[model samples]
Target: MRYVVGITMDKRGRDAVSLALTLAQSTLTSHPVELDLVHVIRGVPPEQAVSKPEREFQKLCLEEAQQWMAKTHDLIPKTIHSTTSVHFSDSMATGLIDKATERPCDLIVVGAASHGPLRRFTVGSVANALLHSSPVSVALAPSGYLPPSRLTRLTCALGMRPGAEVALNVATQSSVLHDVPLRLISLIAFDARSGAAETTDAASDHAKKLLVRASQSVDNATEVMVDVAHGRSIESAIDTLTWDEGEIVLIGSNRLARRQSIFLGTTANKMLRSLPVPMVVVPRFPAPESTADDDISI
Candidate 1:
């Protein structure tokens, strides 16, 4: 598997590298894991000429970026193949997305926004932009995150939304590829008591049907578990669920997103407030209209 890691000169950047390393180490595939560590800097337009002082400043920035990249590269174990580069872009998110697309990477890994609680994720400008526009799946590392000894499980946050099945498929494929257990989770949040039971039950039933579909997609030896978490809000519902030390969450983009693109929905944004583990936001896949037949209520 190939991962494009957005590296900065801060703790958040180190946190991203840590999470990426854990993923690389835990993958069970025969092919070697590769990491592309990229650092983005503000660069003058190719068509524009620069003054001597501006040229000197640019040279200094590049040298400093390369030095930091070298230090970050040394942190990765020799077992994993890795490379470092300095990219020229006005936007950090844009540069990372371009790198991921050019490399055809399986995922883009980045750290959480800096100003957040120690163990939780706060989406910053870069992550927010990537969530809405990245071509590939984007992984967010929580603040102060450290790599676990190994990944314990893979969880798919299944909902009645349009891209729910796409998220399920991606999570299932990852579980099979990495030889990890898969968990299908449905989160129910209700505001009033008027029809909470009916709503919750209907959601649970739909999740079970999705579970059955996921079971059919995997081999007999693969273990698949399904459960539903309920609360007054999405954050509370997420809090009710138990998470393993190395478990990662996978969720799909909103229906409004362009086909095969990512757009973070409101539910996911709420979940992030309380999510202690890393989360991967997947892009919506192109499918027929009939695909949402069983999930029309939501």
Candidate 2:
């Protein structure tokens, strides 16, 4: 499956490119895989489609994106199919979804806007829109995150009691495309990193068993590992592992109610805020079946 990661000059997005590069390298380890990194600049709003400044800004955004791409020419691979385009749609999120569909990408990764605790729930109006609307799976990168690893070592937070098989499936599928191994990390018991080291060690042990169970259930074809980690927060335990320059933290989103608002999961949010590594947030489940032109047949 082709991996499509959406990136931009936005703080979090810029770092996500590093994360995307890590995933790209992993997938291409044996040979080569199709990797497309896209940047979508918002067009004029429908009501003001004719605004002169809007058009000018659009042009500037595209030009800047191209310039940035040129500067990073050395770091990015020549084998990977990389391209940039200007989308003339008023809605940024819509433009992104439209692009993903055109490319028929199997996975989509993007970043959450930089908003404070009070406003994070409503980040990137366009990004949030796509989350609830896109057809294929969508992943969100944490804000200002930079990975210390070159591979995608997933520390999935799925529980084993019930209603968590879906997460297991997500992790396994990711292992296939990422070509990076996945470790089924379950947060057994965590208080704070301030807690005793013994407590954290025990939690990591519990997660290992869950990973073993996951290993047995999924296709044992790929190189996957399972471990249980603990932290003052789930994020800290993940940090305990050694992350290379291109590593990433893939996470799942938490449900936000009507009045509760939309936001990244607790552990994910914390990780994003503190870590420099790139991370991806996989939604709880797949997008609805009915989609508009998600994959054009012809």
Candidate 3:
């Protein structure tokens, strides 16, 4: 039920915002829920800030947030509710994550500020900061992105540490809520340092046990499939497969740390950079007291 999105309060943020709500609606369509849209204004540097212009910009940003919230309420069907916020911070993504953690949303949606799908490189991987620090799932909407009229399924990136249980729980909820099928995949993992002994029958047997338990936990009535691809690296294996249209990928964040900041490590950063499709990075577990709507988590 908790969902958050980080947006830069600038001139170009309007479209990114529109896409954010629309993405939230599209994802939560079947379930019918509200979203908490957090906007952080990282004020201009002192040298760049003129008293009048800075004041004017702040005023305008507040006005836009007010109008945007009104527009969201007006445009989105009445079933869903929205709580809009505008705050000041020096760091956009990090500050938003702090607010989101306190509020404790199930997922986070971010709008891409960079490239297109056609480019050879990652057209937009700007959500890396949020993916690393967030205590919940993060969703990255593409630039000029539009949600499909109907959401068929959500794809998740499986990792070893996060385990399969949490991601499946959120996915199943979305599946049941939106009336869509669920696709569960265990991206075939290849450990470079893995020994030939580990790949033997015992390991496969143990893995089978985990996957079986994983499937049983989710109340997924949708079609499900397991894939095992062969590749030396994660990227190589990932590139070998094709991403389905309208698919929303779910990922999990690292465990909570004492210090808070945006951006993740190299592996996660690479994943975000290489994959052009939308991704949702979930926080590993519940967070500290300060980050939620009702101040519920202590």
Candidate that would win on lDDT:
1
The whole-model lDDT of each prediction reads 0.83, 0.55, 0.54
lDDT of 1 by residue, 89-134 (tens): 8799999988887744778899998887898988999999999987
User: lDDT tens string, model 3, 174-197?
Assistant: 555555555554444466686634
TM-score of each: 0.92, 0.64, 0.70
True-vs-predicted CA distance for residue 36, candidate 2, Å = 3.4
> Model 2: how far is 290 from its true place, Å?
13
**How does candidate 3 score on lDDT?**
0.54
Across residues 9-127, which tens digit of lDDT does each residue of candidate 2 receive?
A: 65655544655555566664553545566666666533454777766766677678777655544456786766555555657667767776785455566666766232122246656
Candidate 3: residue 164 Cα off by (Å):
4.5
- Rank order (by TM-score, best first): 1, 3, 2
Q: In model 1, how large is the Cα lDDT of residue 156?
A: 88
Worst 10 residues of 3 by lDDT: 289-298
In angstroms, give how far residue 21 of model 1 lies from its true place. 0.8
Ranking by lDDT: 1, 2, 3
In model 1, the runs with Cα more than 4 Å from the true position are 45-49, 286-298
